[model samples]
Target: MPDSDLLLIGLGNPGAKYDFNRHNVGFLIIDELARRWGFSLSAGKWQSQSCRERKWGSRVLMVKPQTFMNRSGQAVAEFAKFYKIPLQHIIVIHDDLDMHPGRLKLVQGGGAGGHNGIRSITQSLGGNDFFRLKIGIGRPGRGEVHPEIPVESYVLSNMGAEEQEILESRFDPIEEGLRTFIESGVAKAMSLINSIK
Candidate 1:
């Protein structure tokens, strides 16, 4: 049996300014759960902001890296090592442009695609053996990319009110997914949520 309690790490650029962006949905989910369960993420440790909570008799540690998006792995790796968490016990929650809004995907051990945060984590951990909970952000509108702009700016930028409305509705299922991940396992959570439209 895995001795390490599952560690759920939310990926995003930290700070008030970056809070509401499409890329920050992972952080938003953690924030929503914290609010619902009354946990404080004000603590600074493991190069990230984190909170510890008791849920369904399991100890849950929710992490948000303060190291910005591109270099998120440093904090994550440290947290995993310091807490003695095995790769099998860590779950990363992040935004995915590929999945449509209100869609959720859960996977174990995969490449980071073009996500700098996941890339960094993989680099730091020296492998892609960790669990991932990908929340959809959808791709940008037609012809939005241009020369000379950094992806960092694009990801950290906030979504509009209409976009936010769509995402705002997704919080419930995502919250349930977290609970299910703890109560059941990744396989059960995947079967339950992915089976939804």
Candidate 2:
């Protein structure tokens, strides 16, 4: 088997019922990348659905963890161990409540920001040195219509059509950022992606 130079892990819950939820943006981004790159995620291993593809002169492994959100690190750590991928080469994509919808930011070696999936990955890896592509899913503010909704309930809820539209509009920039990260390095990708509105 060919070794992957970079491992892209998308953190999300597995199951049809949770497919469209806000927390599943990671899965959605992976799906888009797979579709755009002509790779099919039909293989299952290491508690993840995975596919390999050579893009921009690098072998990339794309994985969607089946271990659900909180336990996602198990799958990620397993794949990283088997592939001998360093922490710096592992990139995780997940939803963020820090920014409004349609916004994204790329960072390396940061705290989990209260994201359970990220917390799990950080613990499993014994550190928080990997890269993360945070897709924002803005939280309900005080006195908002859903102000009473808890963060857990809000994240699991499906996105409204308008929110989905906004997200769809940001995919192009996200893809470019990913490509830059894979081909160059995280710093370069961060500079480009973080500058995006």
Please provide TM-scores, in order, for all candidate models, with all chains considered together: 0.88, 0.93
TM-score of candidate 2 versus the correct structure, residues matched by position: 0.93
Candidate 1, residues 98-179: lDDT per residue as tens digits? Answer: 7766577888988888999999999999888888988776665524432344555656778778767777677777778767
Question: Which residue window of length 10 is worst by lDDT in model 2?
Answer: 140-149
Regions more than 4 Å wrong, model 2: 1-4, 142-145
Winning candidate number (TM-score): 2
- What is the Cα-based lDDT of residue 77 in candidate 2? 90
Following a full C-alpha superposition, what root-mean-square deviation does model 2 have from the true structure? 2.4
lDDT of 2 by residue, 76-138 (tens): 999888888889888899999878786789888888899999999999988888889899888
The global C-alpha lDDT for each of the candidates, from Candidate 1 onward, is: 0.79, 0.87
Per-prediction RMSD in angstroms?
2.9, 2.4
Q: Which ranges in model 1 have alpha carbons more than 4 Å from their true place?
A: 1-4, 141-153
Worst 10 residues of 1 by lDDT: 142-151
Per-candidate total of colliding backbone pairs: 0, 0
